[model samples]
Target: MKRLAAYILPVVLLACACAQQPQVSEQTTTDTSTTTPATASAAPSAYDANLAFGPDKVVELKQPESNKVIIKLMFKNGSMSDPKGKEGLTYTTAQMITESGTKDMTVSQIKDKIFPWAAGYGANVDKEVTTFTFAVHQDFLNDFYPIVRGLMLNPAFAEEDFKRVKSNQQNFVDEVIRASSDEEYSKKALEDLLFRGTNYQHMVEGKTTSVQNITLEDVKNHWRNMFTRNNLMIGIAGNYSADFLNKLKADMVQLSDAKPNIPMAGQPNKPNGVQVEIIQKDNALGSAIFTGAPMPVTRSADEFAALMVANSYLGEHRKSYGKLYDKIRTTRSMNYGDYSYIEWYDQGGSFQLPNPGVPRTANYFALWIRPVQIGEGLKQQYAELKDINVGHAHFALRLAMREVDNLIQNGMTQQDFELTRKFLRSYIKLYIQTQEKQLGFLMDSRFYGRQNYIEELDKLLANLTVQDVNNAVKKYWQTENMYITIVTDDSEAEPLKQALLNNTPSPMSYSNLVKEGLPKEVLAEDDQIANYKLNVKDVKIVDSKNTFK
Candidate 1:
């Protein structure tokens, strides 16, 4: 059983990296009530949970062996919130919090104290949440908590510090925005276009308007809003216990419980369409084309497990569609590079997942490619996808990663092992559902939503027939299964656009359709250059074949 394997995994170690302990084998789990630490040692251990962490004051003890601890706090420092399209406000505020003067320490002194802890701590700021994370060795847990609390709770919001961080962020925006041709920017933009009209559309960098309007006070305010006792979750997994819990409580006494001031969850609207936003320039050595749209993963026939397996095949590349580009473009001389990605963000007002801001009603997949051989290159990719057949090999990763994840994350420190065990339970539930589905289908032909994702995924992989995956390909993961594309500076870009427009089997109107290679004009168009907008309608959801002459 899934639980049986997980329970026994601590009996062995997988492999070790330099300066780090061997990775514990694991499978991902759902949230669960915690169990006490095992009274005896099974085998060699990573870190003794008994020695590393203390019990949480806020949450009840459930799983004590969890490696990662999630701690939430109730603190409100609503210095500033960003205005639409006025990016970079939340970050501008965070800078004021940490780098600026604080009540207990000057900005310089604060950074110096926290330096040993945070190599790269903070990210993903928006109107809703601003985070400051500083990670240290489990041994340094008690030692570092106070320093973080001081920076977070008692900030000076100094004027001079405000001026400096804002200037630095502004410079970064100017430089990064200007370098639109870089591979990363092209990929990032492609994602933004797909998930447009949501707060997720903006990255950690808030908008320019938001940044400009942000005052020192506004920055402080956003920080203030993030900390509520109920809204916060704190998990410290290592060798720790009751004494450590008391010490943490004493240290964090300043953080009193506020009302349930958790930030509102990200609502999932039934948003559809793939919008396009392109940046054009001359002499861009290569083009970047991102194709994507919102997908229904959480509420669909394919569950997270199924989707994970399906998406893994679409990308023989690394994170965010880079692999496909290289194999097709760099390897075959198609273009510069290619990439792909599928992810779900958790938001509220829809299906609920454990992690907030995790996927609820939605999942998004992105593909990036620079075409050196446009016609053939695009054709090659779809052809490969068309023939993609999932088998034990394809889904083997689910087994491996799940186990690895379970082993690594399984423990008492994390009171919630329900998620992990739930997934495992579903593994058993897989075969049972298959049998039930057959009976229901024969009885009425009206059986629907009968496929439980986790159970079905295991059965599907364990007994995957070629026809099974091919059928899914025909039904769901086809080339015509809705997508988007953006191409940066290239002489080949326009010709490729022309080719897509004049598809022999399915011709389309290109006059106002595929945006031509051109620059963006905010106020008015310069007469000589073509001004293009990758409008929402331009989001190509590759669906049924259109009428062909």
Candidate 2:
């Protein structure tokens, strides 16, 4: 139905953003498959067969009436394929290929050529896959194909481009990402802890020192290994002739077929107790708290969909209806938001749905408590008055963990389960409302070794019971021991650490004018929660600038 909806409601769903179209050719063979309306009796395959260009090519097409098209060349290798010390090599290479000029055109010339056509390219680099994308009008098919084809096959690889691209990436780590946002910092730190000593440890953009060490030769070598025919899959959606598709496939096949063996990322070592890595920055007013434990399930697991249901009820990303949001944000106004994820959710704070091409074999359950004001003022009054005297991060972590503890101990209520299930059933439609997004999800379905994630999830959600969600939560979600990463002021480091060690009581602080401070029963329940002891494994504070280097 998600697939069918793209064509059915093109005006409402699709936008001007799409992909490449090729020249028509009478000699070329084209797929003549017709779009079929979805029905209960109809098998998914009855809707559309998984079309192919050749032996190695995987193509999924949606023929909407719009002139725009979305073409993606998805490579199986991503940052994980980068050689040691050459981390971010794949990402750098992708930028060099797409952003830099092609063989036939210089950087300036390529920009000039595409500027008039209003055609541009994008790249999504994940731990395991790197997808190169292009969206353009059908009228510019012949003109744009050469430019995109040139980029894929014959990149300029100029010394200037290497320096420019590499510098931009390094500066992002040093400035925007690592320096500015504690929320982002904590998330990165948790991922590092969760995937410690694995290829997945570094950011997709690579670490600062890693980017500094990467040479143009290294980028070229990494590209040669990763960007090959066997490692590639292409997706197209929009208005385009059959001959254009064939031409596009034929051009893509010109690339080499070397399939380099990418090493599988090993499971992260589980911490015995609460292990913390605090990035101490004196300028920081608040701490970004991230807590998570590695889970052994992927989308392929039977319990995955049920856990998905439970995850939504517990802390659906971005939505305010979840338990965590209700408890920490709605009732208490502790922070901007609180959310949880069963799978790796990129741009969780930004996007509602998961991005495509970022497939991870090893997954984890994570909680993100958005940055809140920490010490000294109205913010510190909550802790100071209670005699807890720790930062907001400490209290937020405790309160959020209490919710997790409750979730595991007393699972979801029947009403909550039904509400979340129904919400998800309708809410999921927005995930792939557009043709570009729908195509991305389809490609992701291929990555997870599933027939179709949406279709499978819908069926799973339909038959799922309250018992199923709770059982899955018990099996996968844990609160006893986990990794915690906090990014906060240097002043708050020791105080937060001591608070954790002392098993501090951080009860809610309300105004005096409120006749009812908190419900007596709620306050009584929180007293037990406030004293809940956290088993400390290890705690260390590192200079903020020193991190991701």
Candidate 3:
């Protein structure tokens, strides 16, 4: 259930590129307790009992054959714990801890020492948790422990570091996302709409204004309040001595024992109909569309396994075998890719697999339609459709939703169910191919009250019947109400908005040269997809410049 395929590109490239290693093994410890079946087995019962440090603390996955050691420290608090006005405090504070130097060593000095060992560390903040991850070859564990401990226990919190981290965060929100990656911008916009008026509304980095308002003192204070022994969960993987583990535990005792009083994020506001937020940006080449609805289920739910299979059948992330991908991209060549998710998938564009350490108390079902060509690009690519300025955004959205509605109404056929389930049974095993990813997933299992997510899910998937998957779909899946976000060219915004509102017939356009290869069935289905009705309850168009402000 928990998988960390890769970090964000900027962070991975700039901060932790040296730590990258080829995954040598896919071995993970399986808990015997989870193998048993019971009526009340929805929630995993033996996660704490199997941990090395008992109930509230450490989880270890010892890979004796591995040469690298990976440590992940998760704090129970994150952006949701940010004070009312200081929205980016938790994220900025985490950045300050990982990116800045310790009190005894300068940033350059620390890097110079770590460069030889090929070790690297970084922090990731999400809605409910902030994690600091470290990786080093076991040969350097003795020497690297001090620097890692210093980063956690004694940050310099210097004015330069604070200013630099804050400026970077602000730029990420205000410029980088808006200008460089419209896919991410659309996803952020969708989350904001889904979680509007709630603690989960803002991005983990916060808005541009909120980040600017944060002072250095705000970071320090947030660290003191949220980063405590009571809130920490330690996970380590790879070869390490028992003595080293004890020393690590003793070192962590220096942290304050203050109990974290962070509140859980409330349920996101559900949409009344197809509520849409259109972000109008200048000179965009394509439209990045995201649609989602509150699912009210997490990994701990009984329906999780069933929904997983259904979501995989509809649109698996980054995979080409999904129905949506086959219909929209393979058959019609509408976009780069189309996918769906049952839980939080961070940095979907960068990571081919699900990233771990981003567990959430509240979850939603999401669809990611990677950018569709628009304007001149659309006209040039498919020159057969005359006077077609607005690209295939409308048709794509309609086709995607129509598939979901079809699944809900008719359910997956036995053959489709068998094939998808068989694929998932093998596909999930690839999630824990590395020691870092394996440790991250085991730690995440503890968060969701599970012993081992991959193990539990694999077993759950094996026993699930076609009826079970279809039943779960009928219970949870719906196309009537959703929060939709579209990032498109400024010139096409009004037309796209009008097209959605009017349920316009967006016929597929293909060049004459390419049209000769299409099947008769594909052409027949095009008519139905063009006129698919979308109950657009409301639409708001905002300039991209105004977003995250």
Candidate 4:
């Protein structure tokens, strides 16, 4: 769970290496339609000629020279549709269909058949969509497609599979997340606080009690109700033949024709001031801090492109060139990493690119100040500093907020803006290096009512001026009102809470050898960061054992 995006450079290199490969040009359409399948009269010419759009909702990216095929079946329903008492229903139901066996095949038998083909299919359940993605060589498509068809149309839903998946999900919320990974734990806690009363409040895995309460019958009912033609969107890529595509669509029509009334998630609760939740965990090594506030704009907004430049300049995922990473990790060595996001970045610890199928209508501004040293590790590193009971948690928080405030007060310089915008224009091309990812992004574009998202964003970035970015920064970003979550050792929780409330000065601590190398100006600036004011409105301390209960 403490996984870092350490391989981002290699991923970029791989994308660059494959830049010369042939790709299908993205085509645009003027159609603005809803969930209904496109009629023959309403379909665009490019799709009509290629059979990419028709009675079935299909999004295809064809590459004639490639040897692989990628198929994705996406549904509009996800965790946001969960009922009040059964919060993990949608996610559990998705697992039941994809991870379990079909009516004709056992799980072991299906795996045995597909193992020789070097092909696999899996499911991803996010806040707004559940996508089943399949990748195989074109030679194996004839055999692999039937297995996928069975899983979608006729799942077994055996009691054993249901029990196993439910137990694992319960353990995830009850034990693994709380004990093994404070980094993810702090991030989840922050969302819980930020969207406290909304449907988005719970984790996709749901809570400990909700998962335990789910039964096999509940999964069956959910599948029958939500998996319908109205919620479906089909996407295929690679060197797939039109004949095979037609066959796939014919089989997908066997799904239930009934449409369920699923509504979009409403707005999240706004933060009154600087609200905080301090989680006390035993044997914790350091404090993991996650700060966020609700953002009014989504990708559909005109200002999003400008904010993209601002976000990249502030902190671009795992890249070390960002201002936050430069100040927190590169300069002070306070943590493993520091990053920020304007949109939801799923699994920041693992993925280098934005995972395509997890698009959301609502979003937030998040700052992830990775876990910093505390307790014995801190005392051993900086033996000279007195009154360092809670280590550098306070100082790190103040510094991060102060930098954000600086950005809000005075936007990026013209030089900084130009550099970041140019980098982003080229950097986004790396997002779709493979056929599977390309299809995923194409489907995401439909969700946001765009013809081609990456192309549109690149064009926007190309035309933007420094004033556009600064204006977006001033309009969308703020440091005054936010929700903060800190996961720290039980011994240091009370002290950290008091320091936050008292607005105490938290000076930097360093070993004698390291302090000798620092410049005079750096030490002088440290004094200012130490005393930065935080308008902390409320603070609550909760034990780890009691969380997600």
Per-model TM-score, in order, reads 0.54, 0.87, 0.90, 0.92
Candidate 1 regions exceeding 4 Å error are: 1-87, 114-131, 138-142, 246-277, 298-302, 316-327, 335-337, 344-361, 370-487, 490-499, 504-549
Put down candidate 1 lDDT per residue, 1-549, tens digits, no spaces.
Answer: 000100111111111112232112111222223433223223212222322222222322222442322232212222122445544555565555556655877856655654564322332233344334333444456665665566555767778767877766665454544353344555545445544566555544544445556667666554554443323333322234556644544444333234334333333333333233344444545445555544544433544443443343444233323224323433334344444445432221121221221112335554545433223233344543222221111111112222222322332122122232333344333222221112211111111232223335455455543344334433333222233444444443444343333321211111122224322431122221111111233323211111000
Best by lDDT: 3
**Number of the predicted model whose TM-score against the real structure is largest:** 4
The TM-score, computed over Cα atoms with residue i paired to residue i, of candidate 2 is 0.87
Give the alpha carbon lDDT tens digit for every residue of 184-256 in model 4: 8999898888888888888888888888889999999889889865688888887778678767766665666
Clash pairs detected, candidate 2: 18-69, 18-135, 19-69, 19-70, 19-135
Write the number of the candidate with greater lDDT, choosing between 3 and 4: 3
lDDT of 2 by residue, 1-549 (tens): 000100122232346344333211122234443433223243323113222243224555556556667788888887888888878788888877865787778867866776666666667788888887777777887888888788888888989988888778878767777666778779988888878788988888888888888889887877777787557777777777666766676666556645688888767668888888888886787788988898999988778989888889877788898888987787767688899888788766556776666777878889999886555433445433444356566667777887887888898999999999999888876676666666777777778877467777888899999999999888888877799988988777888777776777755444444316556766676667677777766788878888777
Worst 10 residues of 1 by lDDT: 1-10
Between candidates 1 and 3, which one is better according to TM-score? 3
TM-score of 4: 0.92
RMSD (Å) per prediction: 17.2, 8.1, 7.3, 4.7
For model 1 the TM-score comes to 0.54
Q: Higher TM-score: candidate 2 or 3?
A: 3
